[model samples]
Target chain A: MTATLNIGFARASLETKLFFRQRDAVIFTFSFPIILLVLFGSIFEGDLEGTGITVAQLYSAGLIGAGVMGVAFQNLAIGIAIDRDDGTLKRLAGTPMPRAAYFVGKLVSSLVLAVIEVALLLAVAVLLFDLELPTDPGRWATLVWVLTLGLAGAALLGIAVSSLPRNAKSAAAVVSMPYVLLQFISGVYIPFTELPSWLNDVAAIFPLKWMCQGLRSVFLGDAGAALELTGSYELPKVALVLGLWLVGGLVLCLATFRWTNRGEG
Target chain B: MTTAIHVRGLTKRYGEVHAVGGLDLDIRTGEVFAILGPNGAGKSTTVEILEGYRKRDAGEVSVLGVDPGQATSAWRARVGIVLQTANDAAELTVRETVRHFARYYPNSKDPDEVIATVGLSEKAGARIRQLSGGQRRRVDVALGIVGRPELVFLDEPTTGFDPEARRQFWDLIRSLAAEGTTIVLTTHYLDEAEALADRVAVIAKGRIVAEGTPHTLGGRATASARVTWADGYAETDTPTALVRTLAEKYDGEIPGLQIVRPSLEDIYLDLIGDAE
Candidate 1:
């Protein structure tokens, strides 16, 4: 057990170094969410319709959710597929490293990336845009749980989805097309209130919608609650939905993951 | 000598085709054993099965005294494998790649020392993708042996190497053998087997058709030698006697004297041809 932990840490450190070395990917992942926050916050001017929170402040939470999805889902899924295609997974298979260590290393990398992204997004919003962060201890606790559950859910979903691609060469297109579509209904690209009533029902089936709504509660505080359709953060529902996705995605990935790209002996 | 690998009636099928058909073999510890065969000969499949990376349909096989089919991380640690494919973190420096894999084993060689052993010390800081194919193969060997394993499997380790690089690789394998590492290698080059292996097995149609020391494979050591003089050539079991008679006839040294034994490639070709 201790060996796994040590190996996992070593793997994570290696992954982190590799992740940061790709200057384009690093610049893009960290900057994309913050760029969205700045753009929406600047253009919308003020809170819409009935919500007391400003547009930038309101969208900050959703953008944070988007950042998590990008790092934990898209990046991880594509990276895993490429690794499979390139024989990285097969090389690791010959080692004494536990399979769980590879997974733990991946999860750890996603979590670290997610945390850095969220911190940068929040810092920009709070300092430049006057986004109101929650002062209450309970709400802060809610933020921690929602962020943890949301990142884990998305990352595991990415891992499970990775098996669908024929090879790493095509994995990016296979995963990103659906994800880009999901962004439309999930409110990452559009404000949840402005989305059609029918789309809300459709988006509610996935975890990202609840994740974005949960982030709004933490970042925008009291004023953010009114903007939500439920007239509240819907924190309990968010936890349940994200929790189910996290646990369920893990089961699905474990059952289907293949070390070798080739199927037979 | 301890047995590093033992197999009986091992079989695997890919639907209608049999990849490994009832193959059986044994390899002793501290000896370099080479499996030589052509493409699609099921050598990789059999190696993968013994490495605990593939499933077998029928057979009892043991590697390092543990059934590879049920191998665990501890079992894996004791066996090192350099796969036929070139695999490494492309973005990582050779040093970093070696150091990272080293963490997986309970007893491992120092990463820097391993790098030096594989002649990659100068390129240790270079990204793997920047290195030549042969250099990448050296990295694979470094990773394989860094584990300080009881048994090591090199799956076609020098397939892409130039003659000079291949010779250097053979020296490295010799050093590992001197340290008492049991090595099993697979290759298509007959000379590679002759240079590095203590024993060579010619695999064809998913079975070992011939197995013995490289010097004596296919009765090569005892095969009739060919005596050539200025006039003609004749096959004789006692070439020295024939040469003596020829020298006497010529009144000293035999004219244009030369003796030739069947090369390993010739014997290997004959054996594979007979199997087919």
Candidate 2:
């Protein structure tokens, strides 16, 4: 078991290194969020309505969730597709290392990268946009749990969605499509109050809305809490929803993941 | 007395196509066994089933006393596999790849020693993407044996190798067999099989059509022998009788006379044809 754990860690580190080494991926992962934060901060410098919080704070929380989703879901799905196409995953399947270890390694790497991205985004928000840290320790704890659960949900969703991409090139478009639509409806790019009523109703069914709402409760308090459909900051229920999505995502992944590229054109 | 591989009535179907159809084989410990056939003749499917990569639809298959379908970590660690295509770890050097794979096994050989044994000592520090095809093949070999496995599977390990590199690879396989490792190899190269395998099985259409030692496969040894001289040649069941006639015709020493039986390639092609 110890040896297996070491192998898992080694594989995870190697994967993380590969991710960071790619110039475009690194720029998109680390630098993209910062760019969004700057753009949103400049656009909404003063006088934002609907919710009591400033536009910068609302956008900051939303951008953090978006960045985490990008790393944990979009990056991972594309990576797994490429690895499958290149025969890396199939070769590893023949080794003594367990299949679970390979996925666990990927999860670890994605979570670690997500945490780093969140930290950088928050730092930029505080220094440039004059954002304040949450004063309540319990609220900060809630934020951490929200991020953790969101990461788990996104990672599993990535693996599940990767099966749609038959080749490495198609993987990018496949994984990014849902994310783009989710961004539009879940208030990542636009304020939730500004969206159409029907689209907002549909967005409520997605895990992203709950994640963004949960994050808002931590960072923006009661005004943001009122925006949640539940009308209460129920951290435990949010955890349960994310947990269900994680389990559902894993089942989807197992059912659809392909081990060989032989039959795929 | 122990058998390294025991496969009975193995069957695998890929939807409408049958990849392996009721194949049976027994490979003894410490013997180099080769499976030879044309492309898409179920050679790869058989190897994959034995390596525990693909599941079988039916049949009992065992490798080193454990069922391959139910293979465990300990079972996997004891078996080494060199697949047909080399997986790329472009950022990693040859030595790094070997060492990384070593960590997967419970009892692994030294990475540096394995690299040297595969004749890649100088190329150890070279990144995987920078190495030539033969050098990359050497890396694959290094990774396969780094676990110090008792049984090794080489799936066309020398597919892209040049003549000299192929010969060197043959020697390396021979040395491994000498060290008491049971090797199961699949190759299209008849000379490679003849050089390394103690016994060869010819498969066609998902079944073994012929199995025997290299020299005696498919009645090759007892098949018609061609007695040739500088001028002409004659084929007969009794080469000794033909040679005697040639000797008498030439008055003692037959001029440039030589007797030849069917080569392994000829017999293999005949066996495949017969199966068809």
Candidate 3:
């Protein structure tokens, strides 16, 4: 089992390396979030001071979710779809490598990339936009757990969504549809609290809203005291919800994922 | 010698279409066995089932003495497969790709030695995408043998190769067989089947119509020989006697006279029924 795990890890690392080497993946995964952060930071500069949360804080929360979505959903769904179309998945299925190993590798790579993206976004927020870092270590720990669970949820969602793409050309459009719409509904672009009550209720059912809300509780500190959570960012409940999403997503992915497009061809 | 592959009543289907309809075969150890069939003839489905890639709807298949559907790690380690299309690990150099695959097996051959064995020593350091199609095929062959498997499956191994490259590949395959590796291959080239296979099977629709040595497949050896001369040709049971009579009529050797039996190509086409 240890050897099998190592095989999965190695394969996942190779996949991650391949992803980073692609010019478009690199540009969108790393640079796109940073650009959005900078753009939003400048636009919200004057309005954020009165609310006691700087523009950078808002940008950091929103863009971090965006970064996770980019890697976990858009990156993974399209990547898997293309692999299926190209016969890569079928070839690997013939090998001794277990099917679980392949998914494990994708999960590991997406989580690692999510951590890196979050760290970079926080650093930029702190340095350029004068956003305050979390003061309480316990809160910081809770924030880490939230991010971990949130990323897991997103990755599973991505794998599940990948099955919708019929081929490589249409994969981007299919995978990106839910992601783009989620950005609007889940406060990745607009804050959830400001959205109408009906929209807020709908967005609450999605893991994305919970992820951004969890992050807001971490960074905004006393400003989030009025929020109804009982503890540090409501970590336990958020973790449970995200964990449920992860399981549900995995089930959907396994049921829908095709090893080859032999039917399509 | 032991039997390398033992398959009986193998069956597979795609919806209502039977891809492999009750096929049975046995390949002995250390021999080169070839499967000949046209496109969509269920050859690939049968091979895939034997390789543990596709599950058979109904059959008993034991490769290296273990059922492929319940294949263990040791069983997989003992089998090597060269697929029709090359894997696209374009970013990795040929050496890197070979070396990466080596780690999967328990007792893999040295990567550098495998590269040299496949005649790809010079192209080892080049990225996979940089290599020509034939060179890329060499890389696939290198990866397939890098594990030192006891049985290797080659699916149309030289499909797009030029004449010289095909000959070189044939030599490589022969050398592997000479070294006691059991080879089961499928190819469109009849000459390749005739030259390399110790025994050949012709598949049509979803069943094996004929199986034997290349010369004797479909009674090809005893099939009426064509007696030809400069003027005309005729099929007869006794071609040597016909040629002798022609030589006597000429009072010397008959000009351009030659007796020839049906080639493997002729038998194969006839068995598959002249759809070409």
Candidate 4:
């Protein structure tokens, strides 16, 4: 077990280097959420009805979830598919490296990317949009758990969804379409209140909705809860739903994951 | 020598296609064994089965005293596998990649030494994507041997290499074999088997058609040699005696005389043709 963990750390370090060395992937993954925040923040102005919070601030808060999901889920799914195509998984399998070590490496690298992504989004919101940073230690605590559970669930789901693409050449399109659609329904593109009740219900079935709700509880605090569909932060429900998805994602990964592309065996 | 790999009645089928049909092989320790065959002749399938990358439908197989079908981490550490082509780790420098993989083995060679052995010392800092195809292949070889494995499997390791690169690769394999590493290589190149393998097995139709030393495969060692002179050509079992008769007739060195045995390529073609 110790050897596996040690090798996992080694793989994680190598994976991190590879992740950053791809200049195009680094620029696109880090900047996509910030670009969206800037674009939407400029278009959606004024407060929502009687709420004092500017529309830009609501977007700034919610975009954090989208950014994390982008890094943890979309990036990983596509990256793993490429790994499968390029023979990275096969090479590693031939070695003495434990299978668990591969997952550990991926999880560690995605966690690093997600943190940077979240930090960059937060920095953009604070520097350009005049968004307020939370003063309470409790809010910071909420941010940590929310980010932890949300990312774990998203990363596991990414590993499972990676098997959906027929091949690595088509992985980007296969993985991205649903992720884009999820952002719209999950209130990252538009405020959750503006969307129809049924749309919100449908979004609730996925983890993205709960993730955004959890982030809102952290960044927007009490005022943010008033605009929520439940008229509260729904912290316990957020935890419960995200927790369930985390377990469900693991099951899906076991059922669906393939070390090699289809027909390779 | 003890057997490094022993197999019998190995079979693997994909739907109606028999990818690997009842094949048996034994590779002794410290010997460079080459499995020579045409494309789609089940070379890759059989190698994959021995590498523990594919399950056999029916077979009793053992590698380094462990059943490859039930391969363990310890068993894996003792074996190295170099794939036909891999485009991964493109973003990683040669040094970084080799060093990282070295950690996976319990007793690994020095990463820098392995890199140098594969003739990549000058390009150690270069990312894999920055290297040409031949250079990238050297990186694959470096990774395969850095673990100091007792056995190494190379599946068509030099498919696209230029002649010069192939020569360098052969020298590297020679040095590895000198250190007593049992190597199993698959290639369609007859010259490659002649140059590097201690024993060559010509596989066709998912079965071994011929197996022997490079000189003896398919009765090649004792095949009739062609004796040629300025005025005539003759194929005889004893070319030395034929050359002596020609020399006496000329009262000196036979005029324009040359004796040639069947080349490995000839024997390989004959063997596979017979199997077909």
Best by lDDT: 4
**Cα deviation in Å at residue A246, candidate 1?**
1.4
Candidate 3: which docking quality band? acceptable
| Model 2 ranges with Cα > 4 A deviation | A1-3, A43-45, A50-52, A222-236, A254-258, A261-265, B240-244, B247-259
Best by DockQ: 4
Query: Tens digit of lDDT per residue, candidate 4, span B13-88?
Result: 9999998899999999999999999998899999999999999999899999998889899999999999886889
Ranking by DockQ: 4, 1, 2, 3
Task: Give the fraction of true interface contacts kept by model 2.
Answer: 0.56
Model 3, A1-265: lDDT tens per residue?
Answer: 7887888898888787777767676777788888889988878775343556775687687788788878888888888888877657766665566677788889899888888888888898888887788899977986887788888888888887777877778999998888888889888788655778888778767788778767877887767545432324565667777888888887888787777764632
Q: TM-score for all predictions?
A: 0.94, 0.92, 0.93, 0.97
**Candidate 2 lDDT tens digits, B215-234:** 88999888998888999888
Candidate 1 residue lDDT tens string, A1-265: 8888888988988988889988898998899888888888888886666666777876787788888999999989988988888778888988889888998899999999999998899899899888777889988898899999999999999998888788888998999986777778998878767888999999988788989888877777776676678798888899999999999999989987888775642
Name model 4 segments beyond 4 Å from true.
Answer: A194-197
| Candidate that beats the other on TM-score, 2 or 4, i.e. the better one | 4
**Model 4 alpha-carbon miss at residue A33, Å:** 0.7
Global Cα lDDT for candidate 2: 0.86
Which ranking of candidates, highest TM-score first?
Answer: 4, 1, 3, 2
DockQ of each: 0.65, 0.49, 0.42, 0.85
Each model's lDDT comes to: 0.88, 0.86, 0.83, 0.91
> Could you give candidate 2's per-residue lDDT for residues A160-231 as a string of tens digits?
888788778899999999988987898888877778789988887667876887788877887766665456
- Give the chain A TM-score for each candidate: 0.94, 0.92, 0.91, 0.97
